[model samples]
Target: MEQSTTIEIKDNSFARQFETIIPEGLLTVEYSFQERKIFLTKINTPDEFQDEIFLDNLIRTILDNAIEQRLKVVPTYPRIVQFFKKNPQYKELLPPGIRI
Candidate 1:
C-alpha cells in the first residue's frame, strides 16, 4: 500500500533517541554518540506499525539527518545493519574502513 502520510521524526537528543508518534503508538530509534560516529543501538516499533514502508521512511529520515550533520553512522542494531546491507547507497555514511 502507498503511504500518503509523511513520516515526521523528532530527535530527542536529551533522551538519545529519534521518536515518532503514530496512531499505533510511539516508535523510536535509540542511539549514542562517540566522536563523529552515532551508534544506532535500537529500533522500537509498535507491532501494529511494523510495516516495510514505515520502517524505511523512518530509517531514511535518520540517514538524512546524519547526512546533514556530517556524522558517520554506525549501525549497531542488527536491523539497521541489515538495512545498510540492502541499501548500499547509505554505506557511504558508515565510518571509513567499516563494513556491515
Candidate 2:
C-alpha cells in the first residue's frame, strides 16, 4: 500500500471545498475544527498504486487550489476559528474521532 499526507489549512469549509476538486478515487479527507487540523488519507488500490512523488504532487496541487478558492469566500484563520467557536454545535458535524 502507498500512503501520503499534508496539512496546509485548518478549516472545515476549506476541507469540504477541497474534496470537490479531487477525483473521488484519489483521496479521502478528514477535518477537525476544534483540533484545528486536517487529515488526508490516500486510498490506493493495488492496480493504482504509484510512486510517492506523483501522489505528493497531485495532493499538493489539489490542496493549493482548494485553499485559494475557499479563502476568497471566507478569508483568514481568525474568521474561521471565530465562526466555529460561536457556533459550538457545528462541532457536531465533525466525525466522532475528530470531535475533540
The clash tally of candidate 1 reads 0
Q: What C-alpha lDDT, on a 0 to 100 scale, does residue 99 get in candidate 1? A: 87
Q: Put down candidate 1 lDDT per residue, 1-100, tens digits, no spaces.
A: 3453467888899999999997889999999999999999999888877577778778888998899999999998998998899889899999988987
* Cα distance off (Å), candidate 2, residue 24: 16
Model 2 CA deviation exceeding 4 Å by range: 1-42, 46-48, 71-100
lDDT of 2 by residue, 1-100 (tens): 3344553433346545333223234333343332433433322223555554544444445445545544211122343334335545444433445433
Whole-model Cα lDDT per candidate? 0.88, 0.39
Error of 1 at 85 (Å): 0.9
Top candidate on TM-score is 1
Question: How well does candidate 1 score on lDDT at residue 56?
Answer: 76
